[model samples]
Target: MINSHQALSDTVISNGYCVGCGACAVPEQSPFKILMDSYGQYRAHMDDSPVFGRTDSSYEELCPFSSSAPNEDDIAKQYYAETCEHHPQAGYYKGVYVGHVAEDEFRTRGSSGGMGTWVLHELLDKKRVDYVIHVRSETADKDLNNIPFKYQVSRTLDEVRLGGKSRYYPIELSQVLKTVRDQPGRYAVVGVPCFIKSVRLLQAQDPILAERIKYCVGLVCGHLKSAHYAESLAWQMGIPPSELEAIDFRIKDPSQPANRYSTYAKGPSGEKVVPTNNLFGADWGAGTFKYKACDFCDDVFAETADVVLGDAWLPEYVQDSDGTNVVITRNSDIQLLIENARNDGRLALDDLSIEKAVQSQDAGLRHRKISIGYRLHCEKEANAWVPTKRTKPSRTLNPRHEMKRQRLRTELRDLSHKSFLVAKKTGDLSVYTTAMTPVYNRYLIQKRSFLRRTYFLVKKTLKAMIGR
Candidate 1:
C-alpha cells in the first residue's frame, strides 16, 4: 500500500482529485492544511515539519478520492440494505418527491426549494441535534480577511436561517470539523456528495466524529465551483475580485422561472444583481471554474446521505418562480418528518416516481455516469492514478459526442488552473474571458452539432418504442 501522505499527494493532490472536504486536516494535530489556491479552489497542502511522524493511513482511508474509501454503491449497500429502492444513476431512496416548503418566506429565500434549510431548521427546533454544521457568510468582521462564506456551527434558528441559500463558493470542513471534534454536541451537517462520503469514511474510523455528527444531509451536486465563479459573476456586475465582499448564488427573481435565478454581489460601492444568463462564464455545463475532481465523481444524488435535496429541474416544476425541490429521503425519521409537514400544511409535496428523481438531474447524471467512463479511460491511457469509481470505464460513446466530451474534459482540466493563474497575474477578469470564450464556443458548437442531435433523436425513438 502506498504511504498515506504519498498516496494522497501523488494520486489525489497531484492528479487533482482532492475535493478539499477537510477530512485529512480535521484530525487532532493534523499535519495537512487546507488552503485556497491561486485558482480560488480549496486544496490540501502538507506542512514541511516532520513532527507528525509517518502519515497516518487513516487520512488515505477517509479520503473520498482514495481507492481505500468505499465506493458510493458499497456505502449505499451498507446504509440502505434491502429496504431501499435503487436506480442506476440515483442510487438508493426510500421515497422521491417534488415539493416545496409551504412557508413563503423560507421558500423565497432558499436556493431552490429551501427544503434543505428547513430540514436543518427542524432538526434544531425539535432538539434532535444540538447544533447544525452548515455554510454561511463569514461575519463582516471575518469577511475582511477571509472569503465571503465558510462552514460554521449554528446553534440557533436565527443562525440557521442566515445560511439559507446555496453557496457555490469553495469551502472545506477542516476548521469547522476540528471544532466539532473539540466541542460537545449532536450535529447534522449539510454538504455536497463527496464531502458527505468523506464524512462517512471519517466516521467509520473516528468514533468521536461518528457520535457527534448524527445526520448527513447532502445536496445533489452538479459540480463544485472555484472562488473565481463568484468573482466572474461579480465582475460582470462591475465588481472586481478585490472589492467583492459577498455573493449570493441564488436570488429568486419574481418574473423569472425557477431555473433562471439571479446572482447578487456586494462590493464597496453597492450591491448589484444580475440574471445568471446575462453573465459570461455562468453556464454550468461549460465548467468555467469547476474543480477538476468533480469530473471524476459519479454520485449525482449523494447516495450515502440520510437525505438528498436538489432543484426540481423537470419541466413541470421549472417554471415555478418561488422555487421547488426534488427530494430523496433514505432515513425513515426524516421521511416521516416530511410526511408530517405535508400533512400539517407546512409543506406541499407530491409523490414522485423514481424515474423522475433520475430525470431531475438528467444532465448531471449523463455527465457523471456516462462521460465519466470516457474520462477515466483517458486518465488510464495517460498512466494517471484515477480514483476507483463504481461506474466502469468504457469508450462506448457516440463519435460526435465523444469528441465533444473529450474537449470539454480537457478544457475544464486546464481551465481550473490556467484561468485562475492568468487572472492572478493580470489582476483582471478579462484574461479569464479571453481564454474561456473560444473554448466555450467550441463546446456550444459540439452541443448543437447535427450528428449529436441525430444521435439523441435515434436514442429517444428507440427508448419510446421500448416504452422506456
Candidate 2:
C-alpha cells in the first residue's frame, strides 16, 4: 500500500505479497515494471515512457488480488460441465478440472514441461488463433540494467520462444486484452489460474474481451512467489541478480538420462544448475512474498481455464523425466488439437483417469484437500460466489493416503498457528491470512516431506552402488 505511487499509465500497486511470477514484468513493453522497493517486496512501478498506452484503471481490473467483480462460480462450473459433456477432449480436464500440457518444444523447457506455451503455439500454428497473448521476456537496456527481463507477447512462435521461461516480473493482462481489442483477432493466452479466471470474468463483463479471446491456458499453481525467490536463488548460485543473464525456474535437463530436473541461471562466467527438489521447498510453493490472492483461490485444478498443465511429480514420472507433463484439457477445441498432434506423431501421451489426475496434485499436498469450494457450492446453486473468506476445507484428501495425509495435516496445523500469530500481531488481517492458511500450510509440509524422501532415496542409491 505505497500511496506515494499513483496510477498513471497503468494502475500499479505495491502488493507486498507479489512473488515475481513474471506475470506483470513481461518484456513486451508494458507500462509498468516489477521492481523491489525498500521493504524488499516486489511491486509494479509504472514505466514513465511515452510508449506505454493511454493510462487507464483497466489494468487494476485484471489484477487477481484487487478486482471489482465477484468471483463467478456458476459460469465457471457451467463452462466446465458443458466442455466435458459435448466437446470432451483427451488430456483436457480431470473430471471437471481443465488443464493440459502443450505439445511443443516449450513442454521440455517450461516450468512444467512447457504446456502453457504449447497451447499458445498450437493456437497460432493451427490458424485457430491469429495471435497468442502470452507473456515473453526481453533484456533490459543499460538504463534498466538492474532488471534482467521484461514481458510482452508476439503472434509468432519465434518471438514467443525468445522470452521462453525467463519470467518478466510485473505483467498486466489488461494491456494484452486492450491489444486484442484493438487488433480484433482470435488469441490464446497462458496465465496463472487466477489471471485466466480474470479473463473469463472480464469477458463476462466486457463484450469486447468476450468476442476477442478464444482460449485460456492455465498453469497449475500452488502460490506465486516474490522477487525475493529470484534473489535468494541467484544468491545461492553465486550469481548476483544484476549479473544474471538468463534464468529459468524449471529447466528440463535435455542431456540427462531422465530429464533430471534442475533450476538454472546463466551469469557472466557460466551456468548454475540446482536440483528442482532443492528449490521447491523454501519459496516458490510457500514462503514470504506469496501472492495474497492465491490463498483464497481453490482452483488447483484450474476449473476456469480451457486447459491446465503441470509437472507429474510422481514415482512413475521419474523413469523418462526429460520432462513428462501432466495435462488437463478443459476445452474441446484444445483437446482436438492434442489428439490431432498425437495422431500425427507430434506428441505422445497415455490415457489418464480422473482419479489419477487428482492423485498427482494431492501427492504434492500429501493427499489432503483445501475447502475453497464455496465456488463449487455456488455453482451447484447456479449463483456467483463473491470472492470472500470462508474457513471450511471442501475437497477431501485421498482416503488411501491416510497415513501421509495425517502427517501433512499435523504439520499444516502447526504452520497455521504460526501464521495466525504473525497476522494477529501485524494487525493486517488481509484475506490471505484466512483464505490461504490451509493451502500455504499444507504445501510447505508436503513439499518438505517430498524433498526429504527424494534426498534419502538418492543417498541410499549412491550408498548401494558404492557397497557393490
Candidate 3:
C-alpha cells in the first residue's frame, strides 16, 4: 500500500546510486527486480503496486544506499562493537594477517593467496555451514556468452573448490539469496563491502534468513566493475563482445610480480591470453566501468563482514608470483579457524599490524575515504540528491589536487560506460577507446609528478615575465 519504491526510485535509482547488490529483491513479495542495464551493469527495477517494508526493515532501511539504512559503521558496530577494535577506514577488526594456504593448490589456483576460497572450504569441510554462497565460473560452455559466472550455492568441498578466482564482472545477489531462502540450511555468503552490509540489514528484517545465514564473508573491493570491463579486455584481445564466450580474469604468471596478472579469453575463433597491464582500462585506480555508487562509498575493507580477504599488495608479499592474502577477522570463531589451520601446518600466516593491513590497500582507502567528499561535493553542487554518507561533502577536505583527480576519475567512469554501450551497438571497439584514451591519459598524467613539474615551470616563467 505504501508503494515502497517511490523513495528508492527517486533517490538511489534516479541518481544512479544503486549498486545492484540485490538485497531488496530477496524478499519473495518484493517489487524490486535486478536486471542488467544497457551499460552492462546490473540495476534494481522496482515494480508498481508493491508494499514497502515487509517487517521492521522498510524499503529505505533495507536498501544500503538509503538515508535511513544502517551504514557499514552502524552495522559493524552492532555486531562487533565489544569484540573488535575500530579504525576510521577499516571498521572493526579482531585480527589481521598476511598469509596463504600451504597445504593445497589453492595458492596457485586462486587469483590471490587462496584464502578467499580456503576460508569458505574450511567452513564446509568442518560442517560449520551446510552451504556456501559465492561467485563461481559456469564452465558448462567453455565459450560462455550468456552468463559466464554466477552466485552459486556450493555444498561440498569439491564444489567450494570449484568456486575460486576473482570475478571482476557484474553479479547480483537476488537469485542466489532466493535459493538460500527456499532451501533450509546454514549458509555463508561472500560479497564485497556493500553486499555484506545488505545481508546484515536483511538479516535484521527477516528471521528465516537471519537464522540460516551463519557467516558473512567479505572481499576487500577497490570497486565493482560492470560487465563491459570483461568485454573491453576481450575486445582488446580481438574477441569481439558478440563472440565472447568465457574469460579468466586472474591468470597468475610466476615470472611477474604477484599483483601483475593476465587475462584469458575464449571465443569461437580461438582463445587468447594477455597480460592485464596491456589492456587500456586495466588500471583499477582509474575506476573504469565502475559503478557510480563506488565513487561515494567509504568502506574499502568489508566492515560488515565477519571475515574479509584481499590480495596482499605490499612490497614484501608482491615479489612472490604465488600470491599472498591480507585477511581481517572480526569474529573470534573465524579467527580460531585460521589459527587452528596454521597450528595444523595447513596455513602459513604472519601477524599483520592494522597499520600494515591498511597499507596494503592504501590507494583504495584514500580514494574511498578521502576522495569521497569531492564526489559528494560535485553531486551537491549540481543540486542532485545523494544518499547520506558517513563522510559529509566538502571539496576542501582533501588536498586541492585530489579534487582534480576525483573529477578526472568521475569523467573516466562515466565516459567508459557510455562509450562502451556505443561500441556494443556499433560493433566497433574503437568507439570506447576513442572516447576513453585521452581522458585515461589525462588521468595517468594526474597520477604522476609531470603535472606538478609543468605547473611549477609555467608559474616561474609567468612570475619572471611579470617582474620584468
Candidate 4:
C-alpha cells in the first residue's frame, strides 16, 4: 500500500520522472521549491518542516506525470476543438508551412529559422501581448562560463529579438508565472512541449493565468537535457566546465549542411567553436544527459499549443546552412499574421502537407510514440511507477527493427542517469566518453548489421507481394 499524501514526491520527484516544469511551486505559499540537484538537473524539493498530517492534492493535478493530469489529446480537444485536424504524429493543426524570416541576418542567427523570434516580434509590435516570456542566456561581468540561463519577461521588440535562438538549457516557469499573476498584463509564452503543457495546466486551475497568458507557442522537442550537456560539450572544446561563461548551442557553419551546426563557448581562456559532431556524446539518440520524463512523453508536435515550430529537416531545406523552420499554425489570428507576412514579402513560406510534416520528425515520432511503449514495459518490469501516457505500452515492435529499438531503449534509459552521475562525481567528461562509447558502438552495430538490413528488405518484399 502507498500513501496518497506523498504521491507527488514519491511518484515523480523520487523516481526521476519530474520534468522541471515548476508547476508545483507556482502557488505563493506552496511547500515545494525548484532546485538544481547534484546531477545538474532541476528538481522539486519539499519543505522538511512538517505542518500537517494531510497533503494538498492540488500539486498532483498540475503535475504532467501524475495520473490526474490530462493527456495531450484531451487538452487539445478541450482547447482546439473543431477548428483543427488531429494526427497521431503531428497532433491537431489548422495549417502547416516550411518557411523562414525574409531578413538574412535574423535567419542566420536562429537555431533553425527565425520564425519563433518573428512571431514574438509580431505579438509585441502589434500590441497583441504586453509581454513576451521566453528563455535567454544569462550574462554577468563576473564569470562568463558559469552563467545560468533563465525565463524572462521581455517588454519590447528589441528585448524579444535579443532572446532569439534555441536555448537547450533547463528552465522552469514558476517564478515568471508568479510575476504574471501579481502584475496583470497580456502575455505570450514560448517553451518546449512539456513546459507549454504545464502552462496550459496551470491556466486551467487559476483564472489569473488563464486571463493573462494570451498565447502559447511551442517548440518541437526530442528531449530535454540537463546542465551537464553544456558542460560536457564545453569540456570537449578545451574549456573546463567550471570556467565556462557563456555557450551557444547552435551556430551556422557555411561549409556544412543545415543539419550540421557548431557550438560556441566563451570561457576565461577566450572562446572556442567546435562542430557538434566532433564532440563526444553529441549523438542525440543515445540520450546521454536527457531527462527521464522525456521518454514517457508522446506529444511531439505540442498538441495543446496555439502554434508549434521546429527545424525543417527535409531534403529541400537541408542544403541551406541558414536553416528553415517547419511550422504548424492552430490559431486563426496567428495564421492570418503569417499569411499576411508571406503576401507582403516579409516572410518566405510554402505549403507543407501534414504527411510531410509528420515525415519531418519521423525518427522523433517513432521514438516518442512507438518506442515509448517498450520503455514503459521496462519500467513496469522493474516495478517503477510510470506516468499515465496517451500511448499505451506494448512489447510488440516491428520484427525487422526490434533488436535495434530494444538496444536503444535500454541504453538510453540507463545512460541518461548513469552518465550524469559519473560526470558530476568525477568532474571529468572522459568518464562519460569511456563508458558510452562501447554502448553506442553496439547500438550502431545493430542498426547497420547485414541481418537487420536483410530483414527489412524481406519484409518490404512480402508486403509488396501481399498487396499485389
lDDT of 1 by residue, 1-468 (tens): 656776677778888888888888877667789998888889999876776455476778888888877888888898887778888788899979898998746787788888989999998988889999998878823442235688999998888887788888899998888888889999999999999998999888889899999899999998998887888788779988888887878888889898899888888999888899999878787777888899899998999899999999999999989899999999887888889889999999899998987898887887888788888887897888888888777766655466565667578557746875787678877787787777777777877784577789899999999995
Q: Which whole-number lDDT from 0 to 100 does residue 195 have in model 2? A: 71
- State in Å the error of residue 116, model 1: 1.0
> Model 3, 1-468: lDDT tens per residue?
444557777788889999998988887677789999999889999776535544323777888888878788878888899999998878899989998999889988888999999999999898899999988876622432234688889888888888888899889899988888889999989999989988998899889989999999999999999999999999999999888888888888878998788999988899898999999999998989999999888888999999999989999999998999999999988999999999999999999999899999999998888778778888999999988999899867445677778889999999999999999999998999999999988888888854686689899999999999
Assess candidate 4 and give its lDDT.
Answer: 0.82
- Residue 162, candidate 2: Cα error in Å is 3.4
For model 4, the run of ten residues with the poorest summed lDDT: 138-147
Per-residue lDDT of model 4, residues 278-322, tens digit only? 987777776767888898889888888899999988998888998
Off by more than 4 A, model 4:
1-5, 51-55, 140-146, 400-404, 407-409, 450-468
When sorted by lDDT, best at the front, the candidate numbers are 3, 1, 4, 2
Superposed Cα deviation of residue 75, candidate 1 (Å): 1.6
lDDT per residue as tens, model 2, 1-468 = 422124311222442223333333332445656555433334567665566344343444444444343443544665766556322112235323222344455655555455556667778888998877665554522312233444355777676555445252444464566576678787777776667766776676567778878888876666555454564455457775456666666566655523355667777888788875564234333334444444455556555788777666556774555666677776778888887876776665677766666666763333112433332232235443333322243333333233344444334433433443444345433432464456656665766776787799899999999999
Report residue 199 deviation for candidate 3 (angstroms).
0.4
Error of 3 at 110 (Å): 0.6
Please give the lDDT score at residue 222 for candidate 2: 60
Q: Candidate 3: where are CA atoms >4 Å away?
A: 1-3, 49-57, 140-147, 450-468
What shift in Å separates residue 261 of candidate 1 from its native position after superposition?
A: 1.1
